[model samples]
Each structure stands twice: as structure tokens, then as C-alpha cells.
Target: MKTRLVTASVLLAALGVTAAPPPVSAASLPPVSASSPPAPAGEHGWVTSTLRHMSLEQKVGQLFATYVYGADATAPSAADRAANRAAFGVETPAEVIERYHLGGVCYFSWSHNLNDPGQIATLSNGLQRAALDDGSKGRVPLLISTDQEQGVVLRMPAPAAQFPGAMALGAARSAGAARTAARVTGRELAAVGIRQPYAPIADVNVDPANPVIGVRSFGADPALVAGLTAAQVLGFQDDAGVTAVAKHFPGHGDTGTDSHTNLPVIDHTREEWDRVDAPPFRRAIAAGVESIMTAHIVVPALDPSGDPATLSPRILTGVLRGELGFRGVVVTDALNMAAVRQRYGDERVPVLALKAGADQLLMPPDLRLARDAVLRAVADGELTERRVDESVRRILTMKYRQGLARAPFVDVDEAVRTVGAPAHLAAVTRVTDATLTAVRNDAGLLPLPRADRSVLVTGWDTAAFAPVATVAASFTARGARTTARPATLPSDQAIADTAAAAAAHDLTVVLVNKAWDTEVGDPRASQQRLVAALLATGRPVVVVAVRDPYDIAHLPGVDTYLATYSYTRAAMDTLVRALHGELSPRGRLPVTIPTADGTGVLHPYGHGLTW
Candidate 1:
């Protein structure tokens, strides 16, 4: 297939602009080389030398990492066809790989059958093999990376083990547990032949109204986030040798907007960054993280150019590399994201990103446009040949360090065995058990009536409270009448019903899931209203905040407020055990919750309870 080239002039015209463009100057163009070299014998040694040998077109190809989707290899959708025609003018992965010798690929789970682990392994392995086979220097193993941040951002489903979100881990506040989780997550990806995991989100969640990064972040405290990030990085890279990328740096946790849909402008200054956002990244880099993924948010304080961090030289080269001294590969968040593509024309982005010191231009919407632009820039002496080599050297160095320079091998069966193995499950249990804090227990309503009395259970996603049902079952077995209201209750109705239900039962257990709406505060108001109603019943009510501790202070009427810090199955099971007096709540609140509406004394980090 012939590649299509969309010039900046054409792009501007399409955008309804008729401004005269400046002449393309030689100093503004990428430099080209006349001679090509032979491949070296060492794994990535050949990669570095071959990178040096590349002409302008080949060098440009090295900068792009395009997005590929769908389960069937050949089924192209309308969007895919348009992307192929406009970007690289290629419809198939084989063609794109062969035409530009593209550097890497960022994929979605839609491309493979995730429900079947073996199939996922086969598909990803095949994609990697295909990239290596099409290389000019005889099989350059492409860096296969993905956004497997777990929880809400999880890429793999079913068979793949899903751990609690970063917020849950932060609430647990156990670096040891975070490390264990990372190792398990890394081993799982390594099994599927995925070399890099775009994870260990270093964003500190300060904005409760943050539409995107609420539960995805560790917490609001920068210190705790930095410590946990280092631990997670160590777990993934050191424990499993899987390349873990500390992402959305210099931090996406504080932003209220989602970069996937719109560009978010961070107003913090360099001093603010150094104090709040830069610590976790510095710690991660110091811990030897292999890669750093730049965010799309525009921080004017960091870069006066008014560009997203992904395309900002001040942020990528000046801040991350020069100031913070991160020597590893610097990868961009998906360039195709609306934050970039909707503003800067697709063709001009890759070249600018390369010049900005980005090693990888991830998920460019139009790979062909990016390829041709980089090639044209190189031909025109806009981007230097030395610059291309510099990035290629870094890439090669990382590969060599990862042992991918020697021999690349992935053990599929072993990966499946290690993903959610007994040890990993134990770690999850330990962390959840340690983190569940009883913020308020005025009447000592917990350790609910031993199987000798009647009890009732209720909440959101009521089915999730099955463990509570099991507890009730055990109580019934012990000659107690345990009735469970399986109905899904809106917060207020559930509370009211609990009160009415309490009239019949000796105790009422309200299972609460703190639902956060980005536009509103007090996600627990309904629960609070319900708890008030239930308290009027004169029944012992045990409240569990399944996600955040922010709701605990709002509803103190309940005898006990247990913060599970998450809604994962393991967490639920642990909560059930704790309620039945089978297990003690050993964990503490990793973050503080404000006492009064805006008092800011909820429960400071490191607040917990003993048996």
C-alpha cells in the first residue's frame, strides 16, 4: 500500500485557516545520513548500530508507536480504515510494521480474547514476533506496552487477576504489600510476552472531584504516594525484572479533567511541582524504574509554550531529564488522545515529540502521517540524525539491561500460576485486613450478635455482600435467624428500610459503597441520611465504607464505620470475616478525613484500630 502524506498546509486548510506559512528552513529540519551500517551480533547492539544506519525515513519510523485494535487480525472497521488511509496508508499490522519498521505498538484488550489466558498469550506473542520478523536489521523486538493500571483502568478481564485500585493500596499503606502486588502484576504481563507495563500511577489524589484519577491514585498525601510508588516499581522491576513505567508524570492525580477526552491545564508552579508532584517520580527513578510516561496535561508554569507535557520539551527534557535526572526511556501517553490530535495536526506531532526528547511517540492516531512527517523532517534536516541515535541508544540500553538483548523468553504456564497465586492472594488479604479502619464506633456495635440472635444485612451492589450472607448462614447454622435484604437500595431508602428491618431483627448491618460523583461533594449524604433513619430504629448498625474513608465522618450515627478502602471481592470477604469477630480489623486509615464539612481532620494517615 502506498503511504499518504498530509502536509501542515493541508491540515491547516482543513481546519479552516488560510494563514500564509513560513518557509521550511534547513535548521528546522531533521538531519539525514548517507550510509547504512550492518547489524551487530549482540541482541540490542545491532539495534543501536542499525538505528545509526537508518536514512531519514527509517529514523522517523523509529519514533512512532501506533495503536492497533480488534480481535481478528484482518477485520478493519470504518475508523480503522480511515486511520490506515490517513496515517500510514496501510490496513494491516504486517504492512505498517514492514513499511515504516515502526518502533513499538500500544495495544488494547479488544485485539485479543482476554477471557482465555492461553489465547491472549498466543495473540500477544504473535504480534511481538511479527514486529521482530519485519525488522530490517533482522528481528528488532518491538517494545509492547499497555495501560494495565488495574481497577477501573484494567485492560485484561476474567482469567487475568484484577487487584484493588491504587487508592486501595494507598489506604493499606504497606510498602511490603504494594511490592508483592507489583511482582504478581509484573509476572502476569511477562507471561504474555508484554515487556513494559504502564503502571505504578504516581499521581497523588488531591482533587476529590477529579473525573478521571480518583481511585486510580494512591492518595492525597505526596509522601505516602512517593513511598508506595517506589515500592510498586521495585516490585515490578526488581522482583520480576518486568519493565515498569511510572506514568502520567509529573502527576495526573490532581487534575479534575480527564486527559483522554480533553486537555487539562495544571496551574501549579515549579515550586509546587517540586513539593507535591515531583517526589514520587524522583523516588521511582531513583528506585531504577525503566521508563517514564508523560501526561497530556498542560502545565503553563512548567512550559510557557502552552503545550501538553507529552509534546513539551521543557517538561520532558528540561524537567524530567535535566532537573530530575531520569535517564531511562521517556514514553508519551497515546498521541492519538484528543488532548494532542484535536489540537496539533497528526503529521507534525511525532517530529516535535522526538525533538522534545521523547523516545517513544505512543499510539499516534495516524501512523502514516507521523511516519511521513518524521521522514520529511529528517530529509529536510529538521531533526538531527544524532538525536535519533540518542533515543535509539537509550532504547537499546534498556533492552540490554532487561536481558532482552541476550535471549527473550516467556513462560506462559508459569505466568498463569503466579498471577493470583496463593502468595499473592495472601498479600491482598493482609493489606486489606491491615487497612480496614474503624473510624467511629460510639456504641461498640461491632462483633455483631453471635449466631444466637436475628440479624439483617443490606447495601449497594447487595450481591457483593455475599460474604455477609455467608456469615448470616453460619449464624443460622448456630440457631440464629439471619435475614438478608437482597434488594438494591438507593442510599436513603436502604437506610429507611434498614430501620424498618431493625424493628424485626436485633441487629442491622449496612454495607455502604461510597459512590463518588466528580461534580458533587458528600457522596455519602444518602448513606448518612439512611444511617440517621436506621439509628432511629434503636438497632445496632455497622457501616462499612467500601471505597473511601471520606464518608465515615458524614454518617456517625451507625455504631461502627469500617473503612475497607476498596470494593474488591477479597476486601468484601475480609470485611465479612471481621464483622463476624472471626478476624480483627488490623489496618488503619492511610489518609486523613475532615471531621466537620470542611474541617480537614477526617482521619490522618496512619489511623487504625486493634482487636
Candidate 2:
């Protein structure tokens, strides 16, 4: 699964066979007809009428949604204002939208765009007011978006009622869990006036060594992943009114390289691609997912050209648009990524993506370069005005369908209380309980005596969530005397010290975390050594993998194993309760745990133990 690709075009061309993708109808999920979407509805009369009056520059502007670094829509403070100028050469995101007449904005924690629910709500309202005031003669609303995928990617982390991510939901094998999480997440975002959350990751992670899409993917089984993806899609749009984006199109699942850094290649032939990768996307489109984000990886089998999918017309126009019949917005994954940027600079990427059939350009390196390039492309006949209108119509249609056209603002006070509300967290807690997978309990150490035990909790700090002190406090509140020691690296000194500390406790519960990486042959060798050191004490040791589930594959000596899938507050809280017998370890394995060397399956999918 982690090997180089043979040239499909060279082989097929020599055989005198067409190098195009096999007839998509031959696939399990038959291709939907690539017919034109119906005209805008009566409620969407504004969308159609507004598009008719748009200038070339305005239409080009609507295709982009860039990130800005400020807490305010209009910078109210010197610090916030300076952040905006430094990041985007503007005083606020509002100014960015106005300067470009941009149709959308994206938020990220690194950009200081999210702090608290009230702040997010205020900024969103202010931005929307500004957008509505300036965009298309105030007829259109900005499509605000963020990568709030919850488990591994969450723009608003704290006080947001985060849940265990896709793989965890897949392990639960409950469409109810996926729908509940999506509805909760989407409603919270909508409450903040953010209409889009780039979520419901449709990539099926069949390769254990994939660097970017491990826990984000639902699982390795395409059929199961497809069903869950559709559930989240429906939940986000129909139930919550938030636009759900099925991401990393054509599957970024089997790559060893991170597209943010390097271009990875997937060599799956048409049949293999349909079986292992295309199901979730087909299901998402069938579920009426509002957007599909393109991957930056090159798929030689899909198109023999070396162009990345984001820049390949064959993949985007021919495969996704034609074979999949996705008439919704096509989102291009951050245009500044290495796979797209390494060759195509800021100027060429956006125009190429547009010509390739993408409707939106996200996070381009330079807003001026990207928007201007598309405008020039149209003027020079590289792209036609009709093509630009086609994309803008799609974008406007999505915004109107989501009710962003009718009511584009959220109540600040209500948004403050709605995000991370008690009801939402309660639902999240119940779902989190279902995602706890107990793979091994040979010593039956779980459900430990609450009052009598002196437990030691120590392990690598992944810097995800629910810090070790919080976990230890949870144990302490349960009447156990708990000592917490959390570390980052597993140097010899760190491992020896933690192992020695394990000797003082009646029970040792250590956490081992490892992220998917290109060099994943032994991604956590030092962490594995630390676990071995703890087991060397000859005491009952319970190992909890808080990030990716593949940690257990390399730690065969451990007598107890648990996977929380994510370290969100909800997950950690539920995990503490599960350890105390408040709930059972009921989640099954979503993806098979392959050996560290990627040579064999150490734990098959759906394998789990319950107390």
C-alpha cells in the first residue's frame, strides 16, 4: 500500500487501450449524470439576479476566501489591528473582504480569529454586516468557514464541546453518533454565524502510514466510511443548516507524504480507486454535501499527467464533476500547499484550479495575486466569463440554499450560551462513551477500585486536550490517590524517570501517542521503549493511546490497552468514566491496526473487548 506507482498511461497506451478512467458506471456506486443543476428557486431570485450585474473583478473576488489574523471584523484594538495588517496587509478581515469584494472568509486559531464563543459570534456578526453592506450591492452573504473537524482539527478548541473525530465515530458504528456530532458541531458554528465547517472527511484511510489523514478518516472500510460520511453530511446541512465540505477529494488516504510539505502520489487503478477510495465521496455527493475540497496529491491513474488533482482538469472536471455529478461548490484545499505551490506559484494556482473546475480558492498565498490572476485569465481567453459565472452561480446558490441569504447574523448573547452548552456536551459525552475501544485487558485492571487504589498516570504529552493534570484530577475526584507526570519526548532520561515513578503506585496507567507520518515505519520508537520500561516493572500497566490507534501494534507486551481516538475534553472525560466503570468499552476498531512495519494486520477491524 505504501509503494511507488507504475505509469498507468504507459501501460494502457502500449496495450492500445484508452488511458481514461474505466467507465465509472462499472463501479459499485454508479456515476450520477453530469447534468446541469436546476435554475435558482423563487427564494433564490436574488442569487440569479445578483449574478447578472456582477463585474469581472467582483465575480473573481467571490471565488476566494482567505484567512486574516485578527479578533475583530474591524480592528477595535491596536494589537488586533496590527495583527490584521501584518497578516493580510489590512486592518481587519472586514477590510480584506471589502478590498477584494471577497465572497467568503475562513477562521483559524493560529490567526487569532477564535478565542471565545462571544468573541467569535461578535466577529462573525461584524464581518457579515460588513460583507452584506459591500458584497454584490448587499444582496449576498459571505460564506464563513473553518476546519472544525473536532478530533484532530478544531479551529475553536475550548468551550466548544468537541467530540471524538471520524475514526472514533466509525468505531462506534452508529450513524446516530456521527449525525449527533455533526449536528452539534454544525449548529454551534451556525450559532456563531459561520455557515461552513470544512468537515465530514470522506477520505478512507487504507494506508496506515498516511501522514495527513489518519484519525480524520472514518475507517479503512469504504462502505462503512461511505455510510458514516453521508450521515454527517445530512446532519450538517439538513439538520444544522451548516454547509458541510467532504474533503481531500479523490482520496488523500494512501499517501505517505503530507501535501502541506510534499506531493504524494496514489497509484490506485480505476477499479481499486472506486473500491477503496471513491465510495465515501460518492456517498457524500449523493447525500448532497455542499462542497468537496480537492486534494493536492497527484493521481497518475486518474490522469496520466503529473499535475496534482487541484490543478488537473482531468480529475476535477472529468472525474469528480462528470463521473460523480457533484454540482455543488468545489473547494480547493489551501492553494498555498506545497503540492500545488511547489511548481504553480500564487499567480497560476487559482486560475488553474478555476479552469480545472474548482468553484472556490481557499487560503491562497496572496489574495491580490490569486484574484488578479483569475481576472486576467478571463480577459486573455484562458478562461471564459461563462466559466467564472458558472462557479459564482454555484457559490451563490449554496449560500442561499443554506438560508445565509435570509438571516445572515446570529444573536451574540445566545451564541455565547449555545456553543459548548450543557445539552451539547451531554450528547457529546454519550457519543464519546461509545467510542472507547478496549482492545486488551489481560490483567483485568480496568474498572479499578475507586477508593482503595493509588494510581499513577504518566505518559507523553501530545498537546491535544484534557491535560494530564486534569486526567489525574478526574481520578482523584473518584477517590483514588493519583500522581500525574506527563512528558513530550521519550529520551532515555525521561523514560527511566517515568518508569521509576511507576514503582510507587498500586496501578500504572500510561499514555502512548503517535501521529501518522511519512517515516512511520517506527514513528514512536522512543515511546514504545518507554512503554516497555513501564512494563519492565512487572506490575499491571494499562496503556492508553490518545491520538492514533496504531500504537498498540508495536506494544505487544502491554497487558491492558485502550484507545480514545482523540484527546478532546469529551473523550478524556468519557475515558475517565469508562476506567471507573461508569460505562463499558463498547467501541469496535474502525481501521485495522497494521504492524509498525506495515507488513501485517496486528489487530483486525471491529476487534474490541468490553468489561
Candidate 3:
């Protein structure tokens, strides 16, 4: 039954019509003309003219930015693993442009070939041209957006440059470092005709139990989160000339549940929100952010009625528009997520969101249903024609501001050359070096012996140990026997394996990637148990955390704790350098770790160590 429903949905999506429409056919609607004269300056000339000429149906279609997964048609006999390209033919790009008159598209990594940079570039150019060519007004460029938040949440791998997660940036404690990272990220995205990056997550990491936003957020401090978010926005917009969207507003930092699977309600009071949660968003807006993506979480204090902020006029219009005074575009988190879809069917979401003051409805399940619903509402005077114009104006204003209307194509070679170049790599190195912290070092466990001292390493993903291999190679060059083995047993077994490995070694260096609810397959408990077992061997245990610093409190038995905050190659090298006494551990704990077991950890945001 589920398979049948899914097949129907896929078919309906392919046809671009999911529901029955009113008697007046949308097909009969007039096209927004290319020859339409522009309106006065500062008043969004194209939007005004386009709105005036657009039928009720066309006006409604402008408000939706729908989702297209993989592609439409399959290639002939291509055994390619690039599902996006294989499933969707090259002509599929042109089809989306002509059929839905789509305002924008969210591209997944699987949709384009990441390994072939040239092919990706070609595909991007074709998409842009298709969007403009099908439109009545040739000037309005389509909004191309992506969720490339770096680290584990990265969309494009290999050829596209990947940076450490937000926790690492917070640990670095330098706004300049964050900005440089964002600038490089933006440059890579902009190279492929992707103008908007849904990034620099401003969510302050308040809940360690939060299933989705652990390392994704900067830290738990409002002030530090605000500063880092602003720097990142500036880097993407001012420095790199790409649109930066500060997301999950009012804030997804405090929630314990994941919105992808369920509706997570933030029960904080209005006072608490104003004091802590709202600052980073306010700061980002002040920094001239191009867009703000609404969170799916419900805050009853903000709105007594149980409407999620994504579809709440009280939150979107009253707070964000009226109080905070954000004049830029406001996008909704993917409406297809369970948080929105489970409550309201896909058809009702467009009307509710538009009435709630959202400028764009992102990733709606059925674009045609949403488009038709909005059209019917406008025609019946439920959603005013002026309201449609207002949203269209903001969308166009953003496009113009992004210089997308003027120069659609970027220099692909220049973008590839600039992405993760020498200067960017150096910036990453400096930040990692500055942020490597030695939280506790009893009896001087660090600065291990260069000669005649065997080292037993365990924990962390072995895949991330490629750089460690290089380090081991260098040790081999220095005539030191360094044997690293993965403990295949359970935590206790792993400990036994480590003890066996360390029987002939002087020190046991356990590299632990702390498991948190936010990530998949976090081995926090296993790591803790392994650390305990390794300590039982009477060997000095130096534990290095490559993710969060919260694990320090979990594994207290280990005398020395090193927080690198990320497992990037550069970060790992920096960690190794600190261990060898080549550089001092200068980083401080950016977020606090609780001293007692279950003491309720409090990370007041701006903590970082200085050499």
C-alpha cells in the first residue's frame, strides 16, 4: 500500500499536477511579458510590472520554491552511480523551467556530478539558461539554493571544499577565521551558479540532547554565536558576493527532538527568547543578511495557539517583520519535513504559509497543488493580489541585489582555483592551531617522548585516520616504530585490545570522536568505557576529542583532555603538532562541560583559550 502511494506521488510530481483545479484553467493564464516596462526605482520595478500583467494563477505560482529529488527521466544503459543525473535527463532542467514556472530549485549533491567539476559547471549553466529562457520577463534569474553547511552536512564531496563544523569555529574564537571560512565556502558555491547558501547556522547550542544541531551550531553562548554568525554572513555576502541565509529562526538550538522526524516544541518563555535565543538572528539581520529561514519548532509562549512559527503570522509578521524589522526575504524550512506535513496536508500548507507572511514556501510536497491553491486564494480575494506582489518584490529585489539579474554565469575556472586554495588552507590551519585546547593535564601527560616510547591509539573513525597515517609515516622516517590498530571488540574488548597493544608501549593516546544525539552512530559511551579500560592498564591515557568538548565530563578518569573540536586533516595535524610540543595548545573550551555526572552542563558561549 505504501509503495503504491509513493508511486502515485512520484507520478503526480512528474506530471506537475497533484490535485484537481478550479474551472478556470491555469494553462489559459497570460505569461509575464518580456516587453513589460520597468517600474520606478526603489519600488522593485520588475515585480510591480510582472504582478500587474500576471493572472491570479501566475501570481500564485511565483510564491513557491518546490523540491525536485534526483531527476525526471533515466539515461539509456548508463551504469552511472550519479543518481541525480542518471534519473533526470539533461532536458529535465528545461522541463522544470517551462512546466511549473518555478521560482527556485534546491539542488542535492546526488543531482550533479561532484567528481567532474566541468560537468557540474555545464549542468549549472544549462539550468540557469533554461530558467530565464522559459520566462516572459528575461531579466529575473531563478534562485538556486543549497544546504552546504560543511563537515558532516556537506552536499558536494571530493571536488568541493569541506570545512570543519561550527563547533570548531567557535573553539577557534576568532570572528576573522569564521569569515574566511565562509568566504571560501561561498566562492565554491557561487562558482556553480548557486547564489544562495543556507548556512552559518545561528542556533546557539543550548541542549546537548538536541538530536539535530550539536556540532552544527557555533556554541551555547548567544553573544559568541551572534558574533560568529555575523562574521560568516559578511564573508559570504560582502566578501564572496553570495546570498547567506541565517536559518532555523527563532532558533533550533534548544530543542531536544529532530524536526526531520517529528515536531519539536521549544517551551522557553518570551523573556528567555529575547535574552538568549533571538540575539544571533538579530545580529545576522543587522549584518545585512539576504534571507532568514524559519524553524519548524513550535513556541507556545511566542504564539499561544499551537501554530508552528513557519506558518504563524504572530511570529513571522509580528515578531520578525514588525519587531526585529527584517526587510529581506523570509524562506520556510522544507515544508515536506514531518513537522509541517504531518499536521497539515501538502495542499493547505501554501495558503497557510502565505497568509502567515512567508515570502517563499520551500520544498513543498506538491508544487502544482501549492501553486493552484495560492492562485485560487488570490482569485477569491482570500490572499490579496497586493500580498502576492509584496512577496514577488522581495524575491526579485534579492535577485537584483545578488547581481544575478545582470551576470548569470560566473568564471568556473576562477571559482575552482579559489576554493580551498593556499590562503584558505592556511586560514583553516591557523584557526585549528589557535583552538586546540588542553583542558586538563595532570602529571604532564602531553608532549610525549620522541624516541623509545611506543604509542597505542584507539577510538575515532578509522576513515579519518588517513592524516594519522601521514603522521605515522613521518614517525617511521624518524626511525620510531609506531603501530596503530583498531580495537575490533566492544568497548571492554576494545579496552582489552588497547591494553594488549600498550603492553609493550609507554603511552596510550585515545583519539575519541564524542558521540552526541545530533549525529548518527556516536560512540560516546563506547569511548568512555574504552578510556576507562585503557586507564585501568596503568598506562598514561591522553584523550583527544575531535568533535564536542562535552565528553570531558563523561570520561573524567583520563588525566589529560585535548579538544581539537573537529576531525579535519588540518585539525588532526595541528593536534599531532601540539602533542609533539611543536606548538602550544592555545584553545580554551568555547562551551562549558559539566564537572559532575548529569550536573546539567552550562556553556555560557564565549569561552576559548589563549596561548
Candidate 4:
């Protein structure tokens, strides 16, 4: 038997394919160079050549990075197979990748895709083996991606070197620190064969009430956010050999609504948008960030079509590509998000997003609906095969440039050794120690008069209080009798009982968060009442806003306040050290805290106190 190899010319002629105009303009895509990490300078002839011979279905797969319900790619259970079939029309993740000719796969905790570092490494390597070794023609390395933004939006579970998060980095105001954190995060990710991390959020968080991007954003100041975003991009890409995605393009920082639930319309005038929202993204592009995730929110100033940025040519192609001069891959936010899905439905949204300038359609609600629609569109000439090739060029260029072509497999032992190891976790403490801020120190009460006193620390959420217990342990080291308890509910009775308990201790520490979303008024009324009741006890009360620093705006009467910006373990360990004057509180406010009635600034963006 003789093995026959099909030539590129034969493949193109058989498919009747002509080169389609690439989505990005010539001005946007500079000459490619092996040295140019910022731009795919030389187009890596391999990428374009490989893209040319790819089948239409294979090329379409390169445009999607989807979610599938499975932990094991090679040995999926019956439940995983059924769930994957319902969502992807495939029985296993490897099968779905082979079926879709997928460019990437996004991992989610709920999808059971991430359990531990070792398991994820096995799955990632298995997916690569399926795509390349499973006898597929014109195969490419898989782009394994996930949201590992560290602090609040981490996809991988614990022992993963948790930090105090983006706002905390912004509070510390060190681009070097931001870069270090991204480097640490990327080290762990690359160890597991995951190449891309959707992080270093470029959205300049201007709206205090933004439910979606609160602590995820660096800060409200565009310059501050831009500096950190660029640092992070460099850290992840240049230092760690992983791609860092600057996201929700055109900014999701000013919206009060969350795009995960519904569409948000940003009303920034063109000039206002340029001044407020565009800076971080622009800086990110300048920093050579290869990927940018589109926002599901509408920016009327950029695109008057009322289309979300994810499905808007004016914003994605015109503004992001043409204006910002971005030539790299443009990945849309989850196509299944309510903002894009509700109006366009499952089938039509992927095509619109791609037509609107997205290179990769992420997390389409139904993979079959999205995959088939694009396949049909191309076959009908509704979309040109050339267009599909253009996107695949960008995708393949990324894989090849990142050296995924040469080394697609990872050592599972190395992954287990590197992720969440002592060195990474120790860095977390050093980073978080710099992020602890004291906005109010009434009566010079901090470093508390004595450490051998009774202290009661209370919070209504389990995650926030989990760290309080650790902080209490640190307090106990100082001969302090500390009580750490969680309400995990904002009921009036729970607040009253917690406050009553607070009266028994000489020092009462209240940990509060923005518990839930509300259209108006306080988001956590019971936490506020509990604070007020704690104050009435005539004992010294300390309040810490563990989630969002804005929790202080709702508690008007608290005398001493601190902002940890996140409930991550490193932050908790540092908090106790800061409380007892072991380490100085160094963090400044990243976002201003408004007065209780939202009338005036209680603590400005740069406010922080010392011992």
C-alpha cells in the first residue's frame, strides 16, 4: 500500500477556494518578523500555508474556542458524553475538537473541566494528541485557554497562588507588581499546557456601581489602568511564554449592569470614550498584547448600531483594529452571554460576531448551531472561504509563534511541581502585604493598644470569613483571643445576633461585602445594620471591606476601616500582620469611596493611612 499526500494546490482547486479579504486592514497588520512578538511580523509562512490547504469545516473549527462538559478528554463518562452531545453534538471533548476542528477550548469549573492541575495537564495533552495524532489532515496545536485572573475570577481551584487581585494591584500602584503577578500566574498556566489566560482586564473602571467589573478592573484612572495592563501583558507573554488577553474592549468599566445577565449601553461620547475607556486598551496594544476579548456591552460612541462590541464591526474592526492598529486575533466574549444570545439567538450570533470582526467565537450557547450556521454561510457564499482563511491565519500564526507547533505536550510532573508551589504562594503574601490599605484610623486606634485583648471578627459570606479565620489565627499568635464567625446571610436577625455577640468582645472587626445586586439603595442592608449595632456597643469597631472596597460607602458610622480588595488567602494572612503593626499598611485607594448617600467622596482614589 502506498501513502498519498494531497498538495496545497489540489486541496484549493478541489474546494474552489479563493483567498478572502482578511478582516484586519493592511495598515493594521505590519510586516511579520520572527523577532516581532507584538505583531505577527512575517505571517509565519507556515500559518498561511497550513491555512490554505485546510478543509472548510477545519477552517471553521479554527474560529471557535468552545466549552464542553467533560473532565477527561480521552476517557469521558456517560454523563460527560451525554452533556457534550447536547451542547456540542459530540460525545467527548477530543471528539468535539476533532469534529469542530476547534482552534481552542475554554475551561470552566462548572463544566468539570478543571479539578486539579495534574488532571488539567492530562486533559490538555490528550486534546493535543487527538487533534494531531488522531489521523486528522491539516491538524494544528490546540490553544488551551481559561479565565485565570487570579483573585476573584479564577477558574482553577485553590493552592493556585491566590493574590489580592487587580484593584489591589492598582492600589499598590506598581506596574512591576502587576507584571510579577501575571508572570506567576502564567508560569502555573503554561506548566499545565494552557497557553492563554483571559486577563489583565483593560477596562478602566469608572463607574463605582459597576457590578460586573468592580475589582476585576485595575482602577478608575485610565493612565493607572493602562500602565498595569501593559505590564501584565508583558509579564504573561514575553516572560512566561503565555498569551495575555486584554479585555472587555472599548471598556465595560462604566456600566452599572452586568453583560453576563443583560446588555449594557455605555453612553460615553466619542471624546469621553477616548479619554476614559480607550486608554488601557490602547496601551495594551502598544505593549504587544496578542489577544483582546470583546465586550458584550454597547458603546454608542464607537458604534451607533446599538450592537454590542462583540458583534459590531464599527467597534471591533473599525475602532479596535483600524483606530488602535491592532492586527492580532480578536476573540469575542462568550457568544452565549445574554447580551449577544437573547437577540440573535444561538445560530445567528456566531456568524454576526465573525462578520463583525471577531476571529474566534467563544462559548457559543450551542456549538452545533454556531458551527453549522458558519459552515452553511460559507457554502452559500454568504461568507467567503477566503474570510475563514483570514481568521485561521491569525489563529494559526498565534499557535506557531507561541511555539505550540514545536512543543504541544507538557510534563504532568512539572505541572504538579510548579502550580501553587511554595515560591508562588510566598510571592502572593509579599504582593498582598503591599495592598493592605487603611482609609480610616479614628482615635489612633490601629495597631490596637494591646494584642492580648478579646476580638470578634464577623462577616456574612463564607469565602470572605474563611480568610478571617486565618487572620484570627494570626491574631491568636499574638496572645489575642479572637472569634471568627460567618453569617453568610444578610437577614435582619442574623445581623442582630452577630452584633449582640460583638458586644462581648473588647474589639469587634466587621468584614463586609457587596453581598448581592440591587437596582437601588444598599446592596447589603443587614450588614450595614449590623455595623451600626456593633458601633452602639461602645466598643472599638473595625471594618474590613473584603470583596469590593466600596462596601464602606454603605457603612457610615464605622470608625476604623481597611480594604483588602479580595478574600484570597494571601490577603487574609497579610491583613492580620497589618492589623497588629507587624507590617505597614501600604495600599492606596484604587477607586474612591462615596458618601453613604452617594453625594461626596469619603475617600479619594489616592487615600490611605499609616501607623
Top lDDT prediction, candidate number: 2
Question: Model 3: how far is 288 from its true place, Å?
Answer: 1.1
TM per prediction: 0.80, 0.91, 0.83, 0.91
Give candidate 1's whole-model lDDT. Answer: 0.66
Q: For residues 419-445, write the lDDT of model 2, one tens digit per residue.
A: 889999899888898999998887788
Clashes in model 4: which pairs?
Answer: 20-386, 31-41, 32-41, 32-42, 33-41, 33-42, 460-488
How far is 68's C-alpha from truth in model 3 (Å)? 4.3
In candidate 1, position 139 carries an lDDT of: 49
Q: Give the higher-TM-score candidate: 1 or 4.
A: 4
C-alpha lDDT of candidate 3 relative to the true structure: 0.67
* Candidate 3 residue lDDT tens string, 508-576: 666766433213354456666677777877877778777777667667566787777666676777877
Tens digit per residue, CA lDDT, model 4, 1-611: 11111211221121211111111111111111112112223557667656756788888988999877788986787898998878777799898888878889988888888888889888888888777754655777889999999777888787677777899998898877888798888888887888899998988776667878989988777778888898888888887788889999988887778898889988878887887788888888988999999999988878887888888889888888998999999999888789887667788888888888899889888787789999999888888988888888888888876667667778788788888899888888888889988988886888865546898878755653376677677778889888887755457887778778888998887777773232346546667777888899888998888878877766767779898888877787788778888889999887766655555666776789988
Backbone clashes in candidate 1 total 18
Tens digit per residue, CA lDDT, model 1, 13-121: 2121011112221111011111123336775556666565565565556666766643433445666655555656676555566677766766675543244555555
Which stretches of candidate 4 lie above 4 Å from their native place? 1-43, 463-465, 515-523
| lDDT (C-alpha, whole model) for all candidates | 0.66, 0.79, 0.67, 0.79
RMSD of each: 12.1, 7.3, 11.1, 11.7
